[model samples]
Target chain A: MTKISAEGICKSFAGPRQRVEAVRSFSLDVREGEFVCLVGPSGCGKSTFLRIVAGLMEATSGRLEIHRDAEDGRPLNSMVFQEYAVFPWKTVSENVAFGLAMRNVPRKERDARTAEWIDRVGLRRFAHHYPHQLSGGMRQRVGIARALANDPEILLMDEPLGALDAQTRTVLQEELLRIWQSRRKTVMYVTHSIEEAVLLGDRVVLMTAHPGTNKAEFTVPLERPRTLQTTTDPQFSRLSYQIWEELRDEVQRSMEENA
Target chain B: MSSGGQRNRTREEDGKAHTGAGLMSPAAGTVLLRWVALFVLFNGAMTVLRLWEPLWWAAALVNFVLLVRIAEQGALLVPARFARTYERSLAVAFPLVLLAGWQLVVGAEILSPTWFPPPTRIVRALWELATGFDEFTGTSLFGRPWEIPARLAEDGLKDGAAAFTAESHLFATLMRVFAGFAIGAVPGVLLGMVMGVSRTVRAMVDATLSAFYVLPKIAIFPIMMLVFPNPFGEGPKIAVVAISAFFLVAINTMVGVRDIEPVYLEAGRNYGATGRRMFRHVIIPAALPVIFGGLRIALGTALIVIIAIEFVRSRTGVGYLTFYYWEILSPDKMYAGLVVVMILGVGLTTGLKALERVVMPWRRDPGRSDPGG
Candidate 1:
């Protein structure tokens, strides 16, 4: 079953003098419960594409469709932004319950769901604390819980762990895997990290630099419930290295062109 | 505190080492000799001015400032044994020293006591103003809060007689400030929120608001008087204050709204927040920190405008009392009225700060530990 499909999608940004094409001729089909990671260099429009899918932005020229079986009293998609975009003014529990509260969920049910998500994210102790009081990784956990508590049909994550330290990133990667293993919702994850793509995604979709379009796609033949230790596995290293080899040229070329 | 003392001791030791070396550092030696020369010059000038008599007070004031500067330098040159205690006491001691100097100079009869009354005279006038009612001026400080119970007992809280118990200049000024602040600030915040959220409204009003914002609110007093039927009544006074507060709060609110991070707004939209819900939950909370900043500024502006207006027109406010004392040639009572104004300013600001804490529970002052649940 196709959860999301984009055909000949294009996005262009108009500046003062020139209209720069951000993404051109982009097309992809995402399966119902598959986790697809879009791996690309900076300025490849991976985040632009995700925003278009999440309806935060409109595609300049394309037919993007999200097919749903029936209304499940949940939104079509919820986004986990790169910057941990959680409200600093709200407490951890309030941030997690934001979506439910916006949907006008009953107070008792919202509190229960908020508590459940906070507990799942291992932030029970800090539930009443503000985002400024928490670490960067803890703040991102609030962002994740905020999205998950919405019970959306699909989750759109754009470099959600990019801002965290390496140690915190590894910890969150394992937590994300364990959570996804239990839930298995369709996720479109965008990242610059080849290892993160390989470690998290069931299918990795590669994109080109400048006027970004689909370059290559690979399927991960890994076991379920992958842990942080999975990154040290022979196959995981080979797959990550292979993807990096494909990406290294584009990354250098993009950097040179940008400079 | 100990660390500060240790640092000062090291500095003094360094200074001593430089002096101990027969070749004293030219700069340090010059500074020490200069202060010593200033100390001698100040005393010599004070003695010479005392002999001269009439113009001696002016010379004494100059010498006193020089003495204070020399003392400050001397204090800094030495290592502090208890730096924190010394620093705390300096605040109280410095003012007391100034007061004593003032009393000594006035007692010497160098200047007329009429124009320059001593601290003792000011204290006596302040005490009288606080406790007694003036039959001639028909005004009092605090409406004599001490007499409120007595008045209540006599009048039995009937026929508005109890109101007379607390009808002082301080109360009058406080009432105008609060009434005007409330009248102007509420709608100012609402308009500001509207202007903040809507580009069209902001564009329409931005120029007009900015133009009026820079204009001195007191400049429009005559217009305010014309707007009200009773020109001599409270309407015009409060109107000026309200106008000032309105502009400050509205401008601040607009800026606060405009300054909200786009990411927060996007998150709110993505989470399905729309219209009133978005405003209440996301927009309000996001802009609250800045809005509070604006409110504090608006409050200060309110006090300034009210005092200025009272000085110009009113007969009942603290500002009027200060002017009234000046007209009657009572400098001591004038200073006493100024003290009341200072007290009012501090009290009102403290009240607003308390309100800010209640309204914004999420905000934490740096270095203050959170009393966590």
Candidate 2:
């Protein structure tokens, strides 16, 4: 049940000063419903990697595939972006129902499905509210609900909770865990936070800058129903510290290069 | 920025400190007191000069309270306490404080007020204009003296001004502004939306419009006159308003579209929306506030064009009426016509402001309770 495989992927960006290799020789295989985390320094191609898998951008050179066999007929992967991307004018219900609306779902069913998902994200109160009225965390929940509404087999999230506060971030993380448990879609979550990677990810892909590529992957041995309290456990700390050590040098190197 | 036509900007900025619940500060108190004193002084002088009634004081007081309320809310008030702006000493007040001062100068033979008569004369002139539709009734059919209003009156409008009713010269001029606005604004909105979404289109438009935008459109008046027929009537005037407004709205819409975050576009794409779907659901709503901003700017520009065109040559619009009075050198009627033009302009702007509230109710500027006025 392979959800997606990116074999020998690479990404490069052209800058005014010079050509920058943001990712190179990055390879990974995610199983169906496996929650994978791409953790790295700021300039590392975690987002680039996620984008390639989501079919938003083509990798410089790689083989990418989705499990076409799954009768879902929804796309191989869909993404929930960071920042406030919810269409401001549409109600929360419309945003959640966007994919089905695109597919021309009958108005009644779209309403029902949208209501269900809106309630799933605990935004039932704000189902008719515009995104501008909602807080940043609430807006992010809209983004999450929008992504999940499609029932895509694979969901790619790029620093989805980075813009939120500590309290909101933890709440959303638990929400993500609960949602992931129920639906079990393959997820590639990108982040600069090591703690986030440890808490939510099943396999953390620690990446580095300067020809960004996978440095190592650690399988989280800890159990879920995971929370911020889980981050205090010795196992979570050991894994996070290891990932930090892998990212430490690359981050400093990136800062110097950027400066 | 709009040519200091309004003398008081800080009046509102100062008033902001003394809202419904706030402790009205020292500076706020001084401004309010000054306004009140000015209202009293202006009316007191007028009362003294005209052998004016005690009722004038009540009117002046009501105006003052409303004026303070308007200044407090940073909004304009109808029945504005204009007299309150002159509340210093009646003896030393400026010439045009309440038109009483102007009347005194004219009556006392200090200066010929034929150039700037008192407001009472202007009000008298307005009353005359309303009744005597015989003399100043807007002439129709250009070459002939066909009375458009008389014909309308023969049909109906027992009480309404015949010549000023719909299908008359005044209504005709209004229709031109609206028709031209729609012509320009519709194209402006569509083209602007396209340009806003695409960098290539935006770049193309920016280069072209910036050139024409800076070239004062008045310069084109001569060129347009030569190209069209002798009568600058509805055709050239409408074209002028449309183009003037078109650029403002188009550019604003472009900015609105261009300014939308990449995130929203991607969200649309992620949901399987492409091309028209993306534009319809994603870009348009995202760009509405900016588009409306353009529309507002275009409306003001359209009015400006209407005035300038009539000033150049015409009969019947408020602008044309002003020019006719100016030609006859009747300052009272000319000032009266100018007041009419001002009322129309204010009415149009206020109408569009109300429209903006209805159309894009979600549009908001950050931290402000209201979206915009």
Candidate 3:
């Protein structure tokens, strides 16, 4: 089934002296249980595209739909925002249970689900701690737990591991794949890292910067449980190198558009 | 503390050839030089006091030498083997300096004891006033207590509560201050929160309050008395105290709201938190420390207004007693009543500080209080 479909989505940011077209006539579709990552240079509007899918922002002229079971359940889409977006005032457990509470989940059920996810993320020891008390890596764990506790059909992630240390990022990347394998949820991940895209995604969607439109889409032959060993493999480098060639010419266009 | 200390250490390390553990150390000479200078200043003041013996000089020298020993270890002011902070050094040094300066003025006899009321004299007066329970009781400093239809000592006062009792007077004054403070503070806090949050309310309300706050509450008291019912029956002078506290709280609440950080609000936005949740969880906690600060200022202002109002016309409390003493021109009694007022100020300030510690335990800049603030 098509978990989510985006049809010719167009978006622009209106400035005082000019209208800056960010994404123009962009379109894509993600099948249920598929992992997709969008990658580009700095100004690619990759985050904007993910935000549109999350229903955080509206497209100027396009149709985006989430196909879910309409009779008995409503589809939920949760976003893991870039950096430390976890609520500072809430404990790890409380932050993870935020969506559940919003849906008026019973106190007992919320705690039970939050505890299960906290243990899943290896943050059982830090469950009572506030977000400010945790490091960047721990906070991201809380964010993941918060999103998964809602049991959403679609997870929209905007550079979730971007602020973490090198080691923490590597660890979280594997953890994310492990999470996806167990849950089999459709995810639209945005990032600037090419290796991350090749390793985690089933399909990599590359976006051009100026009036950001689809540049090219590549399917990674690399399979599940992909790790650093995959990066050393010849196929991984060939796919990553091919993506870089298209990205380098488009990066220049992005800079000119920004100027 | 970690970030702030790390920042300082970075600057220090950049300046020196040292790195890491060595960078935590200060220059021995710098610490020694400060220690010697402080000891000299303390001794210099003691010389004027004419109370320093050879023993004090010896102790001062020993203190200087011990300070130099620690300074040499590159651990100056890190609190000796006892794990003490440099705060002690500052605390001891400041009071000693003030006393030294005070002793010089008093020793020179530049002013008469009567007019000057030196620290020694105030201490003596306080002691004598405390001991003379009978002579000090049952009368105003001027000569008599309040005119009471029945003895107030018999009614509600516990044993040893007061030197003398006037039924109508003391209750009237206590009730007035309490009632006025409550009447003003409640609305003041509510209005303050509203105005603090809303641009519309703030624009409309701020002008009127700023104008009211600027006016000396005492100056407006006469006009207010003319407009309202004085009644003169005397349960409490509630009007006088209310006007004082209301304006003070309102002014503070406005300032406290403005002091909150914008980043906190941005953090709340992603959670889809708005309206009441935003206020309950974010804005109020952020403004709490500052609002408590305003309450401290208001408490003092409330007392001042009470005194000024009671002095104009009222039957009870220390303010009326002060007026009665001044009318007779008994300087000693006037001084005694004035002493009571000073004690009240000190008590209020101390109480507020203690209250802040209790109510805002989260606010104690953890870096400062946790072993190394």
Candidate 4:
């Protein structure tokens, strides 16, 4: 079953001097329970495309649809922002339970689900602590737990681990794989890291620089239940390097254009 | 303090070889010589201070300047044991030194006692005013907190509260600040929210709001009086304070709303939050830090406006007491009233800070200085 279908979606911003095209003719069809990674350099509008799918932004011209898959009437999609957009004013459990509260879930049920997600994120100890009290990695965990607790049909992540340190990023990547393997919600993950793209995505969708068009797609041949040790596998490095080879030019082009 | 002593010990050890080589090296020896000269000048000034001559005053002035310069350099050289407490030590020390200087100058009769009564005289007057009720004016400095129970016993709770309020200038000022702040802040926040969310409303009111914001609130007092049925009643006085608080809160709340990160709003919308839910869970909480910041400023403004109003037109309040003392040529009592105002300001501010802690529990660290906290 197709979870999300996007055809010729475009996004443009009006600048003081000219109309800047952020994303142009972007198209993708994501399958239910499939993990798809949109890989690109900075300013490539992979995030913009994700926002469009999440209905946070409107596509200039296209047909975009998200199939509602939850029997319990959950939201269509929930996005984990790149900046760990957890409310600094709310406790960890409160942030996790926010969507449930908004959905008018009962107090007992909301607390139960919130507690469950908090434990899953390994933030049970810091459940009553505010976002400001948590580290960057822990705060991002709260952001992830928040989206997951919402019980959305599709999980849209925009570089969720992008701000974290390399060591923390690897740990979270394993945690993410562990959670996704168990739940298998339709996921559209946007990132600039090719290694991350190959390590996580069942299908890696490469985006170009300048106007952010669909450049290429690589289907990962790696099996599920991937771990930190999986990155050391010869196949993993080979896939990562191959994708890097494809992405190297666009990365250089973006840097040059920015310069 | 320990670090300062340690630094001094290290300096002494390091400078042992460099001592008494003043003209040759012009380094540590020169600093030592400068300190010696500073001490000599200070002692010389102290000797001159005993003289009853105008020429000695010039020498004293020069000595004071030299002492100030050396003290500034000495402060720079001393290392702090506890950074926060060390800085606060200077704040405490400067005021104490100023008070001592005032005491000396007035005691020595260099300044007239009528014009500038010494700190001791002010404290004494403050104590007398606090303890004794004036039969002529029917007021006491503090409403005599010690006598509150006795008054309550004699007059029942209702009359006791009224009597206590009537007797206390500080209480009167505080009541005005609280009433006016509430009257203004609630509507100010509402209007600000409306303006923040709607472009049409913002465009319409922005100019007029800015104009009113710039206008001195005191200038509108006559108009406030006209609007109220009784000009000399509490209504006009409160109206002036409310107007001042209103402009400050409205402007600050508007800015707070406008400054909220769009990402949070987007996230809120994505998670199925709409209308009241969005305002409660997202918008209001997001803007709270800024709104509280505005409230703090509004609080200070309310105190200032209320005091000014009291000075011009009221029979009660700390401001009126100060002006009344001034009218009767009692500078010490006037100083006591000024002290009362400071105490009230501090007390109100502390209350606001406590309220902030309750409202904003997520701000774990009270001070914003420590990013790591």
Candidate 5:
């Protein structure tokens, strides 16, 4: 079953002198429990498209539908943002429990679920710590845990580990794979890293530079339950290189457009 | 690679040598000795020649600089383990040294005792004011704390006994400050939050608020008096105080709300936080640090306005007491009242700090070790 169906999505912003088109006629279908990564250059509007799907931004013109299963009490979607948007004023457990609290889940269940997610993210000991008290990687863990604990129908991630160091990013990618394997939640992941797109996604969708639109798509040939060592596999490198070759011109075009 | 290793080793040695030189610098001892010698020489010349009065001031300034440098050097000598404690003690001791110097200057007849009263005399006056009631003004500093229970017992709760307990200068000033603060800050924060969230509201009121914010609140006292029915009573005084605090807190709260990172708001909305939930979870907490900053500044302003008002019109406040002693030409008692004001300022600020700590546990210094990793 298709969990999300977005067609001809176009987003534009009012600039000082003209209407700046951020995304143009983007169309994609995410299957239930399938992980899809949108790989693009800077200013490709991948994040804009994700935000439209998240309902944080309105598409100038589009048909977007998130298919909800009947009798499912979970939310339509929950997003893990690029900035690790965990509340600095809240503790680790509190931030994880935020969505549940917003949904007015009872205290006992909230605490139980919050604790489980905190432990899963390996932040059990820092449950009472604030975001400032945690490292960048640890903070992003809280962000991931916050989204996952919400138990949404579709998980939307916009460069969730983009702010982390390379080593931390690798570790989090493995953790993300491990988590996705267990639950098999429908996820829409956006990233500028082709390697990340290849490592994590079942299918990688490439986007154009300015006025971003779907350019191409590729199926990941990597095996499931992947880890850091998967990157060493010959197939993974070949796929990543192929995606980079397609993306290289788009990155150059984006730089020129920005200039 | 070998050359790189040798270069690194040489740099490490140079760093160590620099640190060693800094710690045992020969100039440190000579610097202090030079200053002390200059100070002594200047004072000796002043005493012997009985030079110009301006030259005496210059010698005194040299003496003051020498004392400060000595203190700084002395602080360096303290062990690292007790460094913080030593610094705190020096803060207290430096003031005491200044007071002692004042006392010596007065005792030596360099300064008139009547004008620049010694610290001991001021302390004595403070005790008297604290303990004794004044028949002329019908006021006291503490309002007879020991007799409160007896008065209440005889007069009962309904029959004006509460007035006796609230009769002191300190009590009057405190009541005005707290009442005005509460009255002003609550509405200010609400209005600020509204303005912060809504750009239309902010644009509409920003100019008007800025206009009132810059006007000296004390300058509007006459207008406050005219607005209040009982101009001579506490109404006008408190109104002025409330107005001052309101503008400060409102402007600050608006800024606080406006300054919240947009990503947090997006996250809040993404997580299904709407309206009140958004406010409670995301908006309020994000803006709290700045709100508290505004509150602290507003509090200081409130105190300043109240003191100035008391100095002008009121008869039952620390400001009135200080002004009264000035009128009577009792410098000691005036200094004592000033001391009480200082104490009140410190006490109120400390209380606010404690409240800030309670409200903002997340802002506490993160000294905890990473137990997870």
Candidate 6:
């Protein structure tokens, strides 16, 4: 079933000197329970597009929709931000329970679900600790747990592991795959890393730089239950390299535009 | 093997030479002797130049430098294990040295005792102020706390309350500070929050608020007096304090709220926090650290404004006591009043710090491992 559909979506910002187009005529169709990764160069508006889908930002012009089941009481989408936007004031359990608390979920259910997610993220020991007390990787875990605990129809991630160290990133990637395998939610993951996209997503959608638009798409032929060891697979390397070839030109173009 | 043995012998000789050189370097004993000689030389020069007033000050300046050098050397001589204690002691000792110098200068009649009374005299004056009631002003510094129980027993609640009334300078000042702080801070924070959240409100009031903020709060005392129904009452004085505190807190709170990370707000909105929920879960908690910062600044401003107002208008406050003592040419009493004000400032700031800790437990130093963790 088609869960998310975007047709010719455009977003522009009014700059100090001129109107800057960020995303132009971006289009994608995401299937239910399918992990779709949007890979692009810097300033490609991949994050902006994700924000639009999350309802945090508005598209200038387009038909963008997340088809919801009338019976489902969960939120349409919950975002895991690039910066690990966990509340510094709240403990891990509280941050995980934030969405449920906002929805006025009962105390018993909220605590149970929050505890469950905290354990899922391997943050059970730090459940009572604030975001500032946690490391970058742990903080991102809280962010992921928060989105998952919300039980949203679709999980929107914007470079969720982008700020972490290489080892931390790899560990989280495995954890993410493990979590997703258990509860397969529709996800739109935006990343700059081709390998991450190939490793995580069932389909990788490449975007052009500077006023981003869809350029190419590649279906990941890798098997599920993927691990860090999967990156060593010959097909994984070949697919990552192929995506890099398409993305290198756009990365160069972006650097020039920025200059 | 012979060449290696020679190299090892040279290395041993080098280590011995290094240790010998270290031993020759100015040890603590040498430093102490040097400091002692300098101290005596400076003191002797100071004694000789004491007859000449201009040269005496120059000698005193030289002596002061020597004293500081001695203190630094003394600190270095302290063992590493007692470093923290030594540091604290140095802080206390420096002030004591200043006080001793003050005593000597005044005692020797280098400075007039009447105008620059020694610290001993100030302590005596403070004790008198605390203990004795002034017949002339019909007031005291702390009121008769010892008489409170007796008065309550004899006169009951109505007259017993007199013991706690604003007859004491300290009590009056405290009441004004607390009352004005609450009056100003509450509305200031609320208005600041409103202005922070709404750009229209911010634009509307920001300019006028800034104008009022920069205008010296003391300059508006007369205006506040005129605004109040009774110009001579506590109302005008408290109002002036409130106005000063209001501007500081409001501006700071607004900045605090506005400075909240946009990403947090986005996350809040995305996670279904709206209206009051948004405020409680996101905005207020996020802005709390800054709000406390504003409150702390506002509190300090409130104290300053109140003290200044009391100096001009109040008959029963620490400021009034200080100024009155000056008018009476009682420098000791005036110094005592200043001491009280300093104590009050420290006490209030400490209280605010405690409150800040309680309000924002999340901001505690991350170095301290949490009990839960």
Compare the candidates by DockQ and give the number of the best one: 5
Docking class of 5: medium
Off by over 4 Å in 4: B1-46, B49-84, B145-157, B366-373
Interface RMSD for each predicted structure: 4.4, 6.3, 6.6, 4.4, 1.7, 3.6
Model 2 chain A poorest ten-residue lDDT run: A69-78
Q: For model 4, name the residue pairs that clash.
A: none
Docking quality (DockQ) for each candidate: 0.36, 0.42, 0.16, 0.46, 0.67, 0.49
lDDT of 4 at B119: 96
- Report residue B234 deviation for candidate 5 (angstroms): 1.1
Q: Which stretches of candidate 1 lie over 4 Å from their true place?
A: A256-258, B1-116, B153-158, B365-373
CAPRI band for model 4? acceptable
Model 2 / residue A110 / CA error / Å:
1.2
TM-score of each: 0.85, 0.80, 0.70, 0.88, 0.92, 0.91
Give the distance in Å from residue A164's predicted Cα in candidate 1 to where it truly belongs: 1.6
lDDT, residue A229, candidate 4: 81
The digit string of per-residue lDDT tens for model 6 on A1-259 reads 9999999999999999999999999999999999999999988999999999999989999999889985556889999998769999998899999999998889999999999999988888899888888888899999999999999999999999999998889889999999999999999999998999999999999999989999999999999889888989999999999999999999999999999
Off by over 4 Å in 2: B1-112, B130-169, B202-205, B229-231, B364-373
Candidates' chain A TM-scores: 0.98, 0.95, 0.95, 0.98, 0.98, 0.98
Ranking 1 against 3 by TM-score, winner = 1
Please give the distance, in angstroms, between residue B43's alpha carbon in candidate 4 and its true position after superposition. Answer: 5.1
- Tens digits of per-residue lDDT, candidate 4, A57-169, equal 88988889878756787888899999769998898998999999888999999999999999998988888888877788888999999999998889999999999999889
- lDDT rank order: 5, 6, 1, 4, 2, 3
What docking grade applies to model 3? incorrect
Off by over 4 Å in 3: A8-25, A40-52, A56-61, A70-75, A210-213, A249-259, B1-84, B124-153, B156-228, B231-373
Residue-level lDDT of model 1, residues A1-259, one tens digit each, is: 9999999999999988999999999999999999999999999999999999999899999999999875757889999999769998888999999999998889999999999999999889888888888788888999999999998999999999999889889888988999999999999999999999999999999999877998889999888778888888999999988888888888888999899
Q: How would you encode candidate 3's per-residue C-alpha lDDT over B1-373 as one tens digit per residue? A: 5895596476555535653446434654465566567667666676787644434545445555545444433344254564444555655765665555455455556444454545555556545444443234343322223322233445445422342434323344555666777787877777788888888999998899889888887776666666666545342356656776777787778777776665455444434456877777677766777677777777788788887777887666668766775787644445666677777777878988998877655444334211100
lDDT of 4 at B18: 50
Model 5 agreement with the true structure over B1-373: per-residue lDDT tens digits: 6895596466445544766567433444555576577667866777788663445456667678767767665554456799999889988987887788788677766778989899999999999999999887777998887877777788887553566645788989998999899899999999999999999999999999999999999999998889989888899988888988999999999999999999999999999999998999999999999999999999999999999999999877889999999999989999999999999999999999999999999989857556332
lDDT string for model 6 (B68-138, tens) is 76766675556669989988988888789888988987888888898999999999999999999998878
